[model samples]
Target: MRKIFLFMAAIISAFAISAQTQTIVIQGPNGKLMADLSVPSLNTNEKKTVAILMHGFGSNRHRPLLRAIYDKLSECGIGAIRFDFDGCGDSDGEFVDMTVPKEIADAKAVYEYVRDLPWVSDIYLIGHSQGGVVASMLAGELDKDAVKGVALLAPAAVLREDAIRGNTQGAKYDPITPPEYVELPSGIKIGRDYIVTAQTLPIYDAALQYQGPVLMLHGTSDIIVPYTYSLRYNDIYQNGSLRLIKGVDHSFNGYEKEAADIVANFFINTVNDYVL
Candidate 1:
């Protein structure tokens, strides 16, 4: 009985020390958005840097990779905020009809939301898959001031190309399945309800033209977005760098720990001065 009591006490104490994680809500112009904000107590009293995590298409902040990234960032003494895109998770709006333009606006709303925080000294953006594309378009304007550099995680190198894959005349619904693709669980389908905007091409171009100190990380075997996306765009940034992990897939299979470490190192070492 004494051992059982001691074990329970230890579990309770463990939870108390890691209570830095919290779910927070921020209001957009139209409605409210929810996110999990967590930071290690390293600089709890002092101002610390912040990173906003943007998840991929059809994924909210609750995605496994996002949560893993958040935990990784928190352990590295960096404060991170991850939220659901509009119409997904706890955020307002409809995602079925959402487009890149509207999603970018939502990204901007979240960025603005982070900017208003008192303890945030630097605002960096970390995005995965399609989220990386959205972050890239805003890289220039978002980094103008207060915003920092951007991290592109398995970004869709050719977003419009991917978006139009079976979109004959922008009509019809074809699942984004593949022999070489990441093999996302069943029931995930391309959102055909959305109308592709001209913004997609421009965003792709801007992502390739972005000159900031961008860190592009992609799995070598990622067929979903393909690692070539990062390789082909390496020269776009004057200070851009790429790290292609070996034997990794689109979702970075079996390598979340390594991926998280690489991401943390980039934010710490590369993005400090890039933060405007």
Candidate 2:
């Protein structure tokens, strides 16, 4: 009985000190952006490495995918910070004001906030869908050594293609005279600046500049952003690898655990092999 009681106590103690997660607010380009920071309790005495997670268009940081990735990374002893874009979730801004450039700026702000942390030994960036584009572009713009690595999931590099056709969320308009605000099929309002900027944004060329290890994951059956987009990324990234999850959708809907595990392992392995 005493042995069994000790075993149960050990399990309970392990759970008590496994990980720590907290809600935080960071200053963004537009206003305050709500975020969650997760750190592994076991690494409290060591300088920790962190990954910043960015969400997709019309989505917030509290997304299930983001949450799953956050938990998984924390479980692997890495810190993670997932934040809302300036105009999404609990952040302060108007949804109509959202644009790729503005989101890049927002991400930069969050990056800066995390970069200066005394406990942080290395930094990595991960993004999904539109956020993946932002992550790729931002990684390219930063000093090569600034970010240890980058991971993109089903990046919407097609935004540039959509912009060239003057199509904003399935609604066509004259690129020359874009409406003040365009509503997407998801009911999110985007400004003309969003469409106009996409036409000129060089996602692929920009991503090529970041000469760091890159990992791209996409679902083979992704209808929104085809898997070919990630394939193109694999070709552009000098040190990148692409993994296709067979029969998975863009969001990896029912395969969240599998997708999260893959992503978490990629980061964990990269940190162990290179950053540490």
Candidate 3:
């Protein structure tokens, strides 16, 4: 009987989530970005806050970690939009042509779309790994008031350093004269443009522009991108806090729910008023 009740509860929860989700498409720099915007099922009188969720390198909006965060935010009566950067997921671009600048453009396009929405009262940014870098840079590009707060999960600022070192995901190449493309161990080929731009990305210079509240959550055991990268962000931001989760990996493998809760709580506390 208990098992049956749990199964029924899961089904109901899935139904509720699907009912609130909306498919949105925005024209990104390279192509159309496929996105899912999850808004709380609130009445007209209730206030709504939305967050733009960005995924990491070679990841999609539907990644387990990202989806968990999206669901948690929605459950808290917060609106969240998770989208595929051009060349990833269901988007309309090739992965080989993707770059940091292009991903930023994709994020900017989504931000503009959200800013124009009439129902959204406040906006926040939440990103993981490479997506965290894109979110930081995009928030810096826009007005501080535009983004109420930012939450970065295992932000991968080490990409720039890796580019300078001519090594990416254990794939080594000559930084001075990189080939047309370098393929990762996963068999994904990144173009030369990605390497060249990553080598000199004004990541911190642009990220620190937004002097708003920043919450950085990184794991002590993250081997892909060291936790030191997030520490650097915390040190540079005018108002930033870093929380290092011991024993957690870059993907927050065993702590997905905890990581999502942190991001949801950060946005919840930052917002002046919300439905739930």
State the local distance difference test value for candidate 3.
0.89
Candidate 3: clashing pairs of residues: none
The sequence of per-residue lDDT tens digits that candidate 1 reaches over residues 73-177 is 876667789988777788887665456766677888888877777777777788898888888877654545545677888987566765447332233334353
**What lDDT, from 0 to 1, does candidate 2 have?**
0.86
Give the total clashing residue pairs for model 3. Answer: 0
What are the per-residue Cα lDDT tens digits for candidate 2 across 1-276? 999999876764664468688899999878999999886564455788899999998899988888888777776678899999988999999888888989999999999999998788789899999999999999998987889989999999988888788876687778877888877777777788888888899898888989788899999999889999999999987778789989999887988778788887787775458631
Candidate 3 wrongly placed segments (more than 4 Å): 1-19, 45-47, 271-276
How many pairs of residues collide in each model?
Answer: 1, 0, 0
Give Cα-based local distance difference scores for all models: 0.71, 0.86, 0.89
Between candidates 1 and 3, the one scoring higher on TM-score is 3
Please report, as a residue range, the 10-residue window in candidate 3 with the lowest summed lDDT: 267-276
The local lDDT score (0 to 100) that residue 146 gets in candidate 1 is 45
Tell me the lDDT of candidate 1: 0.71
